[model samples]
Target chain A: MESIRKLSFQTSQFLSFVSKNQILLMSLLFVSMIFFSLLAITFGSYGLSIVDFLLGKTSDIQNTVLTEIRLPRVILSGLAGASLGISGAALQGLFRNPLADPGLIGVSAGAALGATLMIVLGGDIFSQYSLGVFFIPLAAIAGSSLVILMLYFMTKGFGYEGVTYMLLVGIAINAIAGVGIGILTYISSDSELRSLTFWTMGSFGGVTWPLLIPVILIIALAIIIMIPYSRQLDLLQLGEPEAFRLGVDVQKLKYTIILTCAASVGASVALSGMIGFVGLIVPHLTRLLGGVNHNYVLPGSALMGAALMIIADLIARIIIQPAELPIGLITSAIGSPFFLWLIFKIKKL
Target chain B: MTISAKSISLELGGKKILDNISMDVRPGEILSIIGPNGAGKTSLLNVLSGNIKSHNGNVSYNNTPLESISIQERAYIRSVMSQFQSIAFDYSVEDILQMGWLDHSHKDIKEDLSAFQNRVIKECDMENLIHQKFNTLSGGEQRRVHFARTLLQLWQPANTKDQNYLLLDEPFSNLDLVHKVKMMESIKAKASSGTGILMILHDLNLAYSFSNKILLLKNGRVIEQGETKKMLSARLLARAYETFISIDENPINIRYY
Candidate 1:
């Protein structure tokens, strides 16, 4: 009887603590993300286990596979997912719309168009300049920045009324970028076409530690810069005018959010082709489980995004064994249905 | 100290929204701006609050140009409660009220305001809805919540001598009789504590009862302005609104058919 009472008391205490402290909940989420990353790193075609590697029982081939190939893939997936998730949360809060995502404003489409152009055109013209590996990511960043600039200029006149126009413009821009990609696809060589197709579909197969490090740094810096704006973002949820009246420099906040989201999403897209749904769904999930305060939502989204991507990548790897499926396919398959459910739940509310 | 707007005119899309409007609000006084629909009362309020830039005029606060004061500094001196209160996210009522404390210095004012916030919450009758989502509240409840938030923004400790102002646009809209009286009492208390209030109220009776001064606006111009008892005559109100109005002298109220 005494043991049972003590156990119930501990259970109630744990529940109360979670209810009281959001940072504690975020830490728990981070631990789960670490667990998912470990689990993801353990699986692959080679049947490598983290336990064996830690115990010093793995062979040289296993070490190479774990350290060089699988580890980078896992880390890249986590980083890309985190960037998308945090960017989504930031954009949603900036726009004061729950449905706002990075893709909603054409950042991902712009990056994809840039990568497609590089894959189709850069190899011939830029190869002589020896811009081999650095060319594509640079082009991707340039393209995303151009879109962000266009969005800024297009929405400049409308004040708070510009949010709806911004979304409409985003759709138009996405269509134009899609047509551009189609033209590039039609003009490309066979190998270039194959790579472009894979790029649009999204994958982590080509990630290497050397290529991943700089992109990781860029995304990490953007997210770190975003952390201090949580209170400002919360104020913005009251609407633009209200936020301004509360002493928030709404214009400065807007520019900062746009630039940071562009950098993070642009870098993630360059690193891993076009991972979809993570940006759209991870933020919603975070807000659903937690509250809408960006203070918790931003960090919660980062951890949740990392976990979801790690799990999705693991499924993509193991579902077909030696032949891998695209991570985007797995994410959309999981995310779209969940998104519908969320819509229905919100309607009921 | 006073906030004075001189010859303020605003044109939007070639239509004059506010034309050469001038007004002054002093500390510890309640000034009510009243007019019919599209009379530019809200536009005038916006211009006075520095939310809108007038095409031709100057607004000064305490003998200094209003535009020269930084937005963060202005936020401490004045708080505005707009007619439209939109909260996109599902923040609780308490969370919404806490946003008003954003500009408070982390000194004695903030430390003492924990109790002040509670008092405003109770005064606004939002004790039951403290934890409720802001979006889920009824329209009247939402208005009270915003009123509480504005009160918190203008809240100062008992010993502080710095003056502040409240600019409310249609604050009593959608409120029932009881809440309207409660909100008026709260505003009176704030004014008595030396916070100037400039509000655009549609209810002429409430304005007559509560306000010290009145400004009647029509067609983007002020029709009459003076002490409430002197300026709120039936002839001035009927001429401004272009309708017949009967005055009840003993109780001091106007009736519009």
Candidate 2:
């Protein structure tokens, strides 16, 4: 009787835990993301107040900082971080392996190759045109899509027997794309090379309103497309045969999810070139806090990703003072060690 | 409802694993497939559950081609539990059960799974093992928990018209005598409660004692299949397993090890 009573109490506690945690944690993180975003907008060359922003009493200094400089940077960083995190979670779940990430699987490299090639080749064609930046994002998306399509067809034809081979092939593809990027670097002019190098290192240096729209739209659309897939993602962790037995169309689901991850990562990488470890770290942290269920993992990762990137950017701006450090350097400096620790821990287990 | 397969065959890695095997399972009855190691028993279960496509012939559920049915509909009809589960994670038993409730509604899942889990734990004498991590459980304990997971998959809304079926591959292999008997009794109870059960067993005596029917497979072909009592004679058992046994039939049923 005592045991029965204790079991019942524990069950009630678990149900309550899931309920309270979902509502409480989600709102807490969402609000923190907004707060940090606003904080990020407020701290650049000039400080602005919430009253001044709301009342539209904008001075030249405040307007320039808020509109031209910090606002777009914060918004773009938020979108890029969210996309990377959610896409990472999706790819990891789809592969049923925790180490799988969109950037690691050559999606970022493929997009980088496409963008570099476009800048090199399309520079000549669009020399007279003002909208030269347009073709780079477009080519990046197309190139990443092409690589995803190639990988998908290769796996389909290989008959799903070799999963480890897929990972190895992804690394090989990234290495080949790296060679392509090197060749593009050799022929480019010094000014263009400097811009490419900064972009490759990843920065929120240039933020215009027009660039922000597509970034926000694509990331928002990706998140929306991903929400309904959480339940299927949960079913997939049981492995492919078991997932198939449980009524998931395993091949079709894999293709759809990989394509989605590829597209989202491609778009984000095009906007903010190769921001590392937001995807890897955010999803794992969400799992630790929210449990393994993707319903919570997806949204939680997005919020945490945005907040982490915003905070990282804040530190990057303040640490150097007047001249900003590359945000990627900060993320990698923090993320790489933690990621290595995770790999070791998993291996030990 | 009934499931019937005719002349099913499988060739893997340029080897014939199963060839031209035939079997049937009736609704609300326990069918046991008894065979030795390397006899393709698990592979046969995989074929029945549609994990692998057959090189020849077809399987049907109530005369409908099993392959023609949607995966969701097929899942609603059957659940399978293999002998080995290698998830290798630190998860609570309740978390594992929640995963089993994937095809179930949130409203009824908690109530139904907890109730079923309670009944299974009581029946398997596994009440103490409930809160333990799955990787921490003993082999026998893990088997019972996996059985609970499979049972959860078998659960459905009361009004659904589909016939529920279970395919188990050597569920009693690692269990002690008491737990083994209890599991057999639970399977028997499921049959009585209107679920079809097909299990592969290595022990012919257990098959004869618990099941309504016995299927003796040798080299991917059925040597004999009929009502358990009439089909499990010493001659047939000896031929199926290639082992001599002294039959000492007494008031209490017994078979010498």
RMSD of each: 7.9, 6.1
Highest-TM-score candidate = 1
TM-score, candidate number 1: 0.89
Candidate 2 lDDT over A69-135, as tens digits, reads 7888888788778888888888777766677666666777888888778777775654466655456
Error of 2 at A92 (Å): 2.0
* Error at B221, model 2, angstroms: 1.7
Q: Whole-model Cα lDDT per candidate?
A: 0.79, 0.74
Q: How large is the i-RMS for each model, in angstroms? A: 16.4, 10.8
What does candidate 1's lDDT look like per residue over A1-349, in tens digits? 0111111111222112123468777988899999998888887777888888999999999999999999999998898889899999998888776666777678888987887777777666544564355666677777887887787788773256667787798788778877887788777774644555455657887677767777887889999988777777887877777777777777888888888888888888887877767887998888888788887888889899988888888888888988899888887787778767856875676
Docking class of 2: acceptable
Instruction: Give the range where candidate 2 chain A is weakest over 10 consecutive residues by summed lDDT.
Output: A1-10
Residue-level lDDT for A168 in candidate 1: 91
DockQ of each: 0.25, 0.32
